[model samples]
Target: MKDDRCEGVIKDAWVEQHWGNPINRLVTKVEACYTKLKTWNRTSFGHIRSLLEKKRKLLAQAEALLMTRRNHEQLRTLKGEVYELMVKEDAMWHQRLRVEWLKAGDLNTSYFHSRATQRNRRNFISKLNGEDGQVVEDEQKIGEMMASYFSELFTTAAPSDLDPILQGIERKVTPQMIQELTREYTAKEVEVALKQMKSISAPGPDEGLHALIKQAAAIGTISGVSLCREGPKVTHLFFMDDSLLFCKANSHECNSVLELLEKYERASGQRINQDKTQLFFSSNTNQQVRNSIKGRLGVAVSHQFDKYLRLPSFVDRGKKQSFSYIRERIW
Candidate 1:
């Protein structure tokens, strides 16, 4: 009994640490079992069944880890974590079944089986809420609240000035601004813009472009460049080859960063192509990219907000062409 309890505790710790990551834990367990089997020279069906049972128990234990603590508050916290894990597991198992079916040249069988499994899992989860009427309703309310909060917080705002700028550019350059100029810009233009921006924003010639590129190349090497709830959320600012600034606030930090960039552009003779700028949410790829450029010149890197930038896109060209050819043709 003590041994079982210890096993349970260890399993729970593993699940908690992994945030109930089943597929990865299962793979690791399977690998361990295979290693043991090889050592023992056990190649029987019974051995395989035993290994499978052990893996299943590990997965069950992981699920059980989420099932502990029955209080409303505790359950609410666990519910979110468990739900995310379940979604991830569903995706993973579906992928696995598809791969296996493809390997066996039984695509139809795999598809139906995966679909059925997913349906059953969903049903089982729905049924797990027990007969407590209030619990179910409360949980639903919490879920709705979370969804609404995320929707409000992460929703992208439409650029208020974009239309006017495009119109002005259309009047100046291309006639069919929306249609013709959309595809005109190339990747080369983006590269050039990045280079020019870095050069202008960097503190010195030695540390400007070269240092920024190096930092971008070796992103993970830097400390303090991650998303943390308590850390400064603001990111560094970039302008049209003149100055870089950093800003920090509790929220909407990306806007502050963009504002600084715009201010720098206005101070300098350079103009920002607002239509081309994009805001990248801080993900693994983007964090690396952001870390690489942080402090290259005067750029400050923080986790305050999502990345925002104006880059050259085909839309501006289209707007120009719309003004040039389409409007002219229509007029």
Candidate 2:
């Protein structure tokens, strides 16, 4: 980017053309500039590795010539050329590795190159489990599977009983909160938001799916087991699509919860993976009740639940034991 020849190519390609939308005009200019830059890089720079090697060989010859003859100017020119190529090589590897904190001019090209290669190897998918539960190794099939999976994951489903669901949820947002949220963005606020964002961070979906499920529990559409005599009832705890549901050890409530899940699947186009889902029962609950509920839900039963978000779902009397993972991570 600092090269004069590259700057000339970009400037030449970025010539203005008439377009109605300013954004479209700008995008067109950028696309043209990128096309020209790629051509310029290929024709002029060639492969960085090969070019660097060629420059090193020439530099070695210049040094030998200088040792015998008094050609100081030629020797200095060759040294400068070699140094420039080395800098470019370092930059190329650094960009691929994306080590933002690593300072410029440190010349750790070999380390960056190795890390980049390792990352590419780790990210490469050789095979994947297809929707049909068979292992797929074909590259094209794997690509299609991934594309279809993510397309469904992020796409919003057809509208469900959203209006009734929203109505069921008690209004918690005050007028002041609404006003503040709806107000036009100020320059200082925008600057603060930009500063708070990391280079790799971007906006994602907010948490609201739990509200509908909570409303269902509140209205007794589904009965949730109590944590304690005074504590609030627990219907479900949700983080993104993952959920942990709690209810009394009875077939009726289990069936009700399964019905709700079916409705959710229909509305959201997201099905629960029964293979990954498990039901954990309280110690006091009878084995017969557990078996009946498990049969109704069509999910396996487990004596204990796995950690949610790397933390134990239920914390007992021994706090240190429950949160030992945190201490281990810190250490």
Candidate 3:
């Protein structure tokens, strides 16, 4: 059965004109109602009490309105509108509270107050360390200092061409990825993509990489190899059959870890998964060493990050608070 609240059925035909057109659930009056509801004063107690009364009245009016629209095609829409408004109240409060670890199903003023105080302290930028051994308290000077620091950092001349750095690296895409990419896509794919896309107000970034790398890397036959100063070593870890050959940028002592995947695959039927793999490069490794290892393993690039599984994978001497999140960060 069709979803009653959804809009626009997939047509029995396809055409080039449909390429850029947006799909639905199309915009609704309920969405507009939520928009208006959000503009009401929520900070003051008296105003919020009045707003709650107004919301109650609106809900009552909506219930009455539903009866009148029941005989028409707008009956389902009426139900959807009321449901959205009911849910929107909690969502609106949750947005204002901004407590990442808490949900909005329950509302209390004390919890919100504590969260607000925490946010204020977290965002307070009272003083900044200046370049020339001075404390910068002035907001304008601090802003200028940060701007200059970042500008110099980003615009620093490239050490060398990235292509050369990546030249000897192995192919990141796999056969599984190729198969997925070459397959014909239908309306099902389009619908799934639309549904998975985050809303405009979502916390994540606007764009995400939608590469077929997973499917490509999932070929269970492939494995990785590595060489350490002690000797050759292979360590390819895979949870399922999806083998993402993640090569962590480890000590220059090892040539490649994928070699271990090969060793493991040869010794056993299992292949390492690249999806769970994270490759972090070290600063001390020679360029030739990187080129050799990357060329041998088909790894084109390395991203340096200090976290692995929410734990600090690398140490920072400057800030004690960098690792403090680990104490509280749990699923």
Candidate 4:
């Protein structure tokens, strides 16, 4: 009976091993099928090619679906984060505006002091003559006296309550009135007005010459003026003069820098002769000259100035167009 029981147990164990779990058996069968499919070719004796094509299509679809879902979830998360940031930024801006309004209400004493000082200097220079040197004592004393006089003048000044003579002057020369006068005046009228003005406040020609000579002498005495900073270190770059005022971050950056420089010149009462300025950038290896320039303050380098042997066919247009025009046509 014991021997019979042992045999039955062995048989049961073998059956269990052979059967296993249905899920595990299915997985093993799938793996075997995959391996066979991978190894199979035209010589294989199964429908492996058709089966592989079907499996591949199914896998591709599954992967595409997963990718789409992931991208959607990521985009939603980013949008929510961006919205939160914007709300915070708006709150900060509102807080800043309130602070600015409060600050604006306070007396800006430093601003007034600097402005008053500059105005005093200007007025002193306007009225000053060499004969008044004794009255001023010294240059430093003159500056202090001018400041004090201006301070007193400002203290005594009334708002729109000018003396009749000053009021008449204001009535005649309101900014709008001046603008209208300017519009009405012809070149001949302007010339006549200037002549009358010069006659009324004329310095002798000798005195004018002496003043100009003094100015020249003063400028000549300024011995320690320095030049602008050194140019950039890029190999393919060149500058026409010592004006390191321009920058070339890239093609776009270069254009922007040129525009900014032009704007600055307008604002600062300076002029830029673009005809004299040289701009350089890398182009195709076969292009002619490494540098080019444009006439006047134009930022667009002329095609004629470009020496690149492999000049793009589209660059022949005489009119200035966007860089995109050249890029699209060339590349």
Evaluated with TM-score, which candidate comes out highest?
A: 2
Question: Worst ten-residue run, lDDT, model 1?
Answer: 205-214
Q: What is candidate 3's TM-score against the reference?
A: 0.35
Superior candidate under TM-score, 3 versus 4 = 3
How do the candidates rank by TM-score, highest first?
A: 2, 3, 1, 4
Tell me how candidate 2 scores on lDDT: 0.75
lDDT of 4 by residue, 1-331 (tens): 1123434443443344434698887666556554544444223323433544555565455556766566656455545544443333333333323332323223333554455456566655523333345544477766777787556544522223223213222233588877886775588986686776622244332112122222323433211112335642321222332242322323443344444444434333344554445454425422333222232234544344453334432343454652455677879
Lowest lDDT 10-mer window, candidate 3?
A: 206-215
Model 2 scores worst on lDDT over the 10 consecutive residues at: 159-168
* lDDT (Cα, tens digit) per residue for candidate 1, span 1-331: 1113434534444443332478887776656554654443333222433454455565555556665644555445555554444443444344434432333223234565667677667655332233244444365765665577557554544324333223222235556776776867888997687766622143433213223322322342222232466774323334554333232221344343444344433333234443333333233445554544442223333333233352222233365653464456679
lDDT of 3 by residue, 29-132 (tens): 34444443333223322254455656666656666777556544444555555454544454555555565654545544566657766877888899997767
For model 1, the local distance difference test gives 0.42
Give lDDT tens digits, candidate 2, residues 111-213: 6778889988988889999778999999999989999987866565554754544565578999999999999999999979987885455676543346657
Q: Which residue pairs clash within candidate 2?
A: none
Order of the predicted models by lDDT, top scorer first: 2, 3, 1, 4
